[model samples]
Each structure stands twice: as structure tokens, then as C-alpha cells.
Target: MVRGDPIDRRLRTLVLLGLLLGLAGCAGGAHRLPYDSWRLGLFAPNYMEVWIETADAVDVQDRVFRRAMNGVAAINTPKNLKGDPRGWPTRSGAGAGKQVLGADLPRLVYVRWQSLAEPQTYEAYIVIPEATRRAMVKPETGYCPARGIWREDYRDMLTVGLAPGGIARVWLMGGCLSAIDVVRVQGTVVKKGPYGGKSGGQHRPLSATSKAYIEKYGIPYGSW
Candidate 1:
């Protein structure tokens, strides 16, 4: 009986030590930061003060285009964006573009073009750190803006990049939008695939249904 008592005490001490060690291991790994896969710092970002001026020839069509572009940029900045599992980013917003900046913690930066000028254009500068530049590759070719001639089509096709990283991506999409647009924002770390993939430039022609909505509601979407 006496010998058994000593052995039991030693066993209890060992069990307690093991539990403490396991907890310490978990604590150490919990706060570790995620590592980005792309090579950084290859693209030389020029130091240009943000400036944009539209020619006098620009028209109302150009002004409307500028307003939509601003709306898209606003949507991408904060909680309106998400990363696609297939490597592309998607907007989490309800109607138009998603806001994704704060949620994803991506290192990419987006800035709206400095002015509300005609021939409306916005610029995004992708930055790569000095380390990742070697392996970094440019985005795929399919990601271009669609030039929609119709008003409804123009609004739907307008989009901006959200939570961008070493690679910059902008996408345009159009469809039927309800009055109570519900925007859902989510985030995932993208480690591989094309920088910007899919029908980025794919423009959606204004459907008969959307035209009816516009006729009834007269620009259901609010002003920029």
C-alpha cells in the first residue's frame, strides 16, 4: 500500500505538467500571423500626386459614369468584399460592389481618382514589398472594364477593387437589384491563382426587366 501511494503521487504530477505544456503550445500558435505567398517589391510605384482633369468635351454620360465609379470605390473600402475560394475576390455588398477593406486585412491599398472630372477614371496602385517581387506575376488578361452604352448597364458594370494585396483587381457586374439591397461581406486569405480572373470586362446589357424598374422607380439607387 505504501509503495502504491508514492507511484500515484508521481503520476498525478506528470499529468498536470503534460496539460500545462499542451495549453502553452496552443497559446503560442493561436496568435501567429498569416504569411502571404506572393513575392513582394518588384513593381516600381511612381510618385505622382493624385490629379485628374477631364477635357471640356466630356458630357453628362461621362458625369454619370464618374458617379457610378465613385459608388463602386466606396463599396470596396470597408466591409463589402470577400475572397473567392477559386482565387478571385467577390463583392459582399447587397446591390452593386462589396466593401472589403477592413475585414480581410489585406495589404493592398485603393484610392479613388482625385477628381469628379469627365471621362471619369479611377486609379489603383498595387504595391509589392521588397521580398516578394521576384515571384510576383501580373494579373490575367480577362479583367478589363466593359463600356456600357445604356444607363442601367453602366451602373451594373461599374466596380472597384477591395482589400487588394500585392495584386490589384477590379471587376464589373450587372443585374436586377431590389430596393432592399442586402450586402454581405466575408474574408478569406488567398494564397494562389490568377490575380484577377473571370469576366471582369464582361458587360451586362440592360435587360427589359431592369429598364422597366428604371422607368417605374427612376434610378432606384441613391446619389453618389
Candidate 2:
């Protein structure tokens, strides 16, 4: 009921194809991997965390960051969702200055962008079934900003289907970190499909810079 018939059919076909092609081992192996392995790259349970950067380098003064943050905050607020944490970063010095005051921050700072192109400005997360380690996608999650950290709370979920190796690949669109993680995790944004679908929705072909970045980062082909 949660997923559409078309996607389920595609997954079944893919499973059958993999079995027929003698890729059952690969498929089985990926399936058998502990949920934590899939979540955190073979790390200990609860050790998985992903840091995504924008596709284009957003300047501290970019309007896109401000606008996107505003959108996110609107989605997060109790008036909407009644989230606890408050105030996302802005192009103005206020957010930047606030970030500077944080402890143990990353050396590379993230500035806002001029544009958060359609699909580029999405959120994502993961979920694990009780008997299985495979994390499935959920319908929606709450977006809460607490003490400057962004958190996705997986209250409900819906997942996208791709091959096992898909989650390993992260896309870096340009010099900036514009990439999408192809896995299901708590608080992750739903970027694809009708309900969460973008207005423009389609991605323009990658530019040379984007290609180079993807290559340099060793993005898994499944990521695209």
C-alpha cells in the first residue's frame, strides 16, 4: 500500500534479472550485509552519518541559501510541524556569525547559494525493518534545526528502489557538494516522485565541472 505497483514491479524484475545473470551472489551479499553496514559504510551500528554539500558553491551572501532555509524552516515550524529548534542560517552575517561561535565545526564553511535548483534542494533519510537491516524510505519526516545541527525525524517513510551498490555513490554536482544520497535514513528528505516532486523536476545534464567532481569523488554510478 505504501509503494506503487510500478516500482514494486521494477524491483521484482531487477531481482529476477540479477538472479538470471549469475549476479545472485552480489545481490545476496548486499542483501545479507547488516543494516548498519548499509547505513554507515560497514561501520558499527549507529555509526552512520552523511554530510552533503550544495551542488554549487554557495556564497555566504547567496539568496538561495536564505530562501531554501526559509522554506525548510517553514516546513519545520510547529505552526506547521511544531519543531523545537529554531532559526536556520542566512546570507546575512547573523547566521554566519552564529555558526562561527559553534564548537568543533568543520573547517570548510557552507554558504548559501543563488539558486537551489529544483531537485537539488531536497532532504532525505533512512529506515530499517525490525527483522531486516535494509532501510526503506518513508513518506515524510520532520525537519528540525537544533543548536545549528539539522535533523530529519523519521516519523513516516517511503523508499526509492535501486540496486544494492546504489547508496555508496554520492553525487557532487559542481565544485560545491550538490549530491543526493540514495538510501533511506531517519530525517532524510524525499526528493523524487509525485508528492515530494519538484515543479521542474528534471535534472539538466551534468556539466564538465560536475563530471570532474563526480569522477574525483568516485561516485557510484547508481547515485545518479
Please list the C-alpha lDDT of all candidates, in the order they appear: 0.22, 0.21
Q: lDDT tens digits, residues 1-224, model 1?
A: 00001223313433243334332222222222132211111110111111211100101111101111222122211112121112322332222332221111112222333211111223332221212211112222232234333232111221222322222233322332211111112222222211222324222233343334334434311111
At residue 85, what lDDT does model 1 achieve? Answer: 17
lDDT of 1 at 94: 28
lDDT of 2 by residue, 57-100 (tens): 11111111111111110111122322222121111111111111
TM-scores, all models, native as reference: 0.19, 0.19
Q: Which parts of model 2 have CA positions greater than 4 angstroms off? A: 1-128, 131-143, 146-154, 157-204, 214-224
Against the true structure, what is every candidate's RMSD? 24.9, 19.1
Give the TM-score comparing model 2 with the true structure, all chains together: 0.19
Q: Which number leads on lDDT?
A: 1
